[model samples]
Target: MRILVFGGNSLLARAFTASAPSGAEVRIAGHAEIDAPELLDGVDVVVNFARHPDDMRLPYDPARDVDRRLAKRVSPLTARYVMLSSRKAYAASAQWDATEDSALCGQDVYGANKVASEAAIRRLLPADRLTVLRIGNVIGPERIPGRRSFMGFMLNTLADTGEIVFDMSPFVSRDFVTVEHVAAQLGRIVELGLTGTYNLSSGTGIMCGELALAVIRGHGKGQLRIIDPRHADAFRLDVSRLVRETGLRQTADEIISYCYNLGRALG
Candidate 1:
């Protein structure tokens, strides 16, 4: 199989390339090449991880729908199109996990954009030729602890002052999956020619406090403190479909271990 990946610089793209099947030929296209029609020639599948140039810009503009534009261009050239949607596409329903059939009720701008992109892609291609993956938090070495990301803020604070503070309780939970797992599952999905919407996740939730503790323990120091005992905006994805189809599953323990090892490796 010949696969072409856009947003080649993205962390997920790197992970996918690293673990791509041996029989598959993978080519990466940066922002410049994404617009080149020739890049789509001879590509069996095209995975898009690219973000619109206007993403997160203060004055939001719907006209800058890059995902839709990319889809329109690539759908005609490639046999299969895989879009990386986010769990943010779903609203925080504290009651239950989100399944592929769940409503796209998220109010966040980012999530709304993903929802729009998904709709546009679905309109452009049939179910057999398209795959939409509503992925959860992916943990990996994409960002160093001291960088400007969520993991960076937590670990940096711990490293600098030996204390990690959170506005929510430690029990505030969310789903997290390893980059390796995502890469592997994506490989399987592509090889099997599976299409349709799927929630790509570990099917479990991990507490925020527990995550901090694990990283702290791995670093061999640091502490955790929750300032607010308020309700947690927790969410989880129902990955039964993914598991039934791909035989992929993950545990909280494994998620914690992955974070711990990441912390240790950062030192």
Candidate 2:
């Protein structure tokens, strides 16, 4: 199979390329390089991992509308198109485990962009030709310190001062999936031609305090300071569709352990 991946420099894109099938021909391209539509010729699948939610300077509507148009252009060129979305696209509610059918009432600009992008893809491509993966918190080794992600912040702070600080309560829980697991499942989804939306997550939640402790233990020494003790709501994704379709299992302990070790190694 011939596969083209946009966002060659992204963590998730790198992992996916590494985990792709041995015999598959994969080409990596950055956003600038992908401006040439000829690159998609004879490509069996196109996977887009390029949207940036961390850029505060970029306005929401412009970014989202651009992505929508890009999706429309790419949908007709390939046999299969996969878009990486975020779990943040779901509506804020007391619900713990959200499924694919949940309301997409994202209020944040980043989340709203994802919703708009998903809607655009669905509108442009046939159901069978498009696959949307609503991913959760992806944990992996990152080279740069003080990046925008939670793991990035924790790792950078720990490495710099041998301490980690949390302004919020540690009891807050969130779903986290390893980059390796995400890569493996993405390969399966592409190879098997699975379409529609699926939640890619650990299918379980982990407390912030527990995750911090694990990181400290993995690093062999670090202090965790919590400014506020008030607990926050726990949120997890219902990944039944992923398991039923791909037979992939995610364990929280293992994922967290891998991330902690990766952070320590990077540090």
Candidate 3:
């Protein structure tokens, strides 16, 4: 299978290409430097992971443009398209376990843009040919401090300050997932020829504080303290459908250990 990957500079892109089996052909194009749809000339699938930081300035919405181009323009040329979406696209309403059956929503600009992209892409590529991976929080080694990258930053902050600031919300919860697992599962999805939306998550809910505590433990540190609340309305994703689809499951401890191990490996 040939894959034209946009935003190939990302660690995930590098990891996917490295781990991808020999039969698959993966080509990458910079999100900002897309041209002629030349990258997808004879590609089977286009996997988009491009998103704006919101702080950055650009012409038109980046998410919409990529989605529209790939779904409308690229999909017509390719055999199929697989879009990387977010759990945020789900309605704020809490379900026992979030599934593809859950409602679609746009809570904020970030999510709203992603929602728009998903819609446009879906319009171009139906659920049968197009696949949407509504991924949960992706954890990895390059946990840059003070950035939005969830697991790494928090863990680094905890290790440095001993008491990291927090916005405690009983309602807020996240499904922790590892980059390794996500890439592996997604690879399996394509290899297995499955279609439709699937929630790729750790399949467990943990608040910011719990994640912090896990990070501390992963670092072999003692229990930590929480500071305050930044925002309300817990953000959680239903991943039952993903488990059913992939027959894959991830535990919070596994993710915690992965990050900690990454930190150790790096240093």
Candidate 4:
């Protein structure tokens, strides 16, 4: 299978390129190549990992329409399109795991933008030729420090001061899938010719505290401290569809070990 990829420098793009299956042939497209329709010639699929800046404060900004424009450019091509969406597109739900059919009532600006972006792309490409993957928190060897990347921030703190601090209670949970696993799943989706929206995740929740502790264990000396004792909502994705279709899933222990291993690698 021949593939063309955008956002070639992103973590997902790098992971997919490095971990693609044996039969897959991947090509990273340059900025100029995106405008060239011939770039999609003989390409079986086009996976876009590019992100758009969405600011509700600036509602009329044209810069926020990057995805829509790319959809328009690639719509005429024969290759199927794969879009990487986020789990944040769903409204906060504590009663049940969010499914592909769940209401897209996410309240944040980023979520709202994703909802709009998905709709816009769907309008351009027919359902049979489009695949949207709503992914969860992805973990890898990110070492940057800041709120922009949570794992990176935690690791940086541990490296600098041997401490990992949390503003919310450590028990707060979120679904996390390793970068390598995400890449492998994408290969599965492409190879199987799966279409429509699917939740790509670990199918379980890992507590923030547990992950921090694992990281500390990997770092060999860091400690976890929680500044707030208030409860925070835990969110997980229902991966029944993905598993039934691809025979792929992740256990909680595997998720914990992925974090632990990341800590060891980055420490």
Candidate 5:
């Protein structure tokens, strides 16, 4: 199979390329490189991982940009489209795990952007030709602990200073998936020509404090300091579809271990 991936420089893209089937012909390109019509020729599948809804600068509207790209660069081409969406697109529901059928009433700008993009793709392509993957927080070897990202902040602080000081309670939870798992599942989905929306996650939630402790344990040392005693509610994704279809399962501990190892390697 001939696959074309956008956002080639992204960590997930790199992971996907690395984990792709051995015999599959994969091509990686940035937005600039694949903007032309000729680049779409002979492509069997197009996996888009590049677009960000955060760029609200002039002449770069997220919804409009996705529509324009699809209308001009992708729609005319004969390739299946796989869009990488975020779990943030689901409205906040503390009582239940968000599923594919959940309401797409995301109030945040980023989530709204994904909703818009998904709508546009639905309109532009037939259901059989489109596949949307609503992915959770991806943990991978490429992560670097820093203030910019939550995992980074926790892991980096603990690894570097041997202590983690969190302003919020440690009870906050989120679904985290490993990049390797996502890449492998995506490869299989493409190979099987599966369509429709699927939630890609670890099918479980992990507490922030627990995650910190796991990372520390994995590192063989560190401390967790929580300044706030108030607990935060947890949010999880209903990955039954992915599990039923792809048989992919991962625990929060597994993800934490992966992150810790990556941090150790980086250090």
Candidate 6:
């Protein structure tokens, strides 16, 4: 079976493709060509990971545009379109864990755009054939703990410097997932030909302090200066819908350990 994977160069896309069967037939389409439905002609699945043109930052903007282009290519196409969206859409702008049926409120640019993009895709394909994965923050072997992806960045910095300060409140309640798990589920989704909105997450979350200490313990180094930042709102995704449908669950500790080992290898 041949599949067309847009966002050819994204890290997440790379993980998905690399984890596919060794002999799977896959074609990568550049973001520049996504609007041309011919890019995926004769394809069975189109996994879009593009960024919006407006995103100028090195990685974030480019990824945002990939999805932007994806929203454009849905019509007149007959392939299965699976979009990777974010958990930000339901955040309370502070802290919240929302079920799939919650009243969605898109706050950030990333969240707002994903909400818009999902709307566009659903308009073209019914919820049955079109899949929108509202995903958690993803971590991998190369995750640099001190970089600006917020949590990862801060932790890495503290590890490097041996000491760092950060404001922590009632510990944000967001989950982090691993790419490997996501890839496995993506394959299953294709096998079943099922489509619908689902939350793909770690199934549990770590408080800010817990996440920080985990980094320190996993590396056997660093001192975290936990500051008292007011209770920042966070979003917890209820992935039970996905669990019931796909039978996917995750142990946060295992995923966190994977991050540590991957970081060790990179270093």
Ten residues in sequence with the least summed lDDT for candidate 3: 55-64
User: Once superposed on the true structure, which residue ranges of model 4 sit more than 4 Å away at CA?
Assistant: 30-33, 54-63, 94-96, 145-147
lDDT agreement with native, every candidate:
0.80, 0.80, 0.68, 0.80, 0.75, 0.67
Question: Candidate 6 overall Cα lDDT vs. reference?
Answer: 0.67
lDDT of 5 by residue, 1-267 (tens): 999888888778999999887699998878677457567778889888787435432333644455447534666666889998878778766224888999885536666677777877787887888899988877665436344566767766766688888877888877878888899899888888889999888878877777667667767777888788776545688889878887778876678777667656635
TM-score of each: 0.91, 0.92, 0.84, 0.92, 0.88, 0.83
Clashes in each model (backbone N, CA, C under 3 Å)? 0, 0, 8, 0, 2, 21
Which pairs of residues collide in candidate 1?
none
**Per-residue lDDT for 109-224 in model 4, tens only?**
76667777788899999999999998888887887656357687888888888899888888888888888889989988988999999999997888889988998888778789
Candidate 4 clashes between residue pairs 3 or more apart in a chain or in different chains: none
Regions of candidate 5 where Cα sits further than 4 Å from its true position: 53-68, 143-147, 229-233
lDDT (Cα, 0-100) at 56 in candidate 2: 30
Candidate 2 residue lDDT tens string, 48-133? 88865452334356454544655666766656888888887888782379999998966356676778778877888888788899
Can you write out model 6's per-residue Cα lDDT over 175-262, one digit (the tens) per residue?
A: 7777788887776776667688888887687665666666666666666676687766465677788888778788877866765564
RMSD of model 6, in Å?
3.8
Q: What is the lDDT of residue 49 in candidate 4?
A: 80
Q: Candidate 3's residue-wise lDDT over 1-267, tens digit each?
A: 887777787767767766665699888887666656366677777777666555133333734366677677665564677788877777677333667777776545555666777777777776777888887778777556566566556656666765445656533676778788888887777776678878787778766666565555556654544455455655556667766767888886676566557545433
Error of 5 at 95 (Å): 7.7
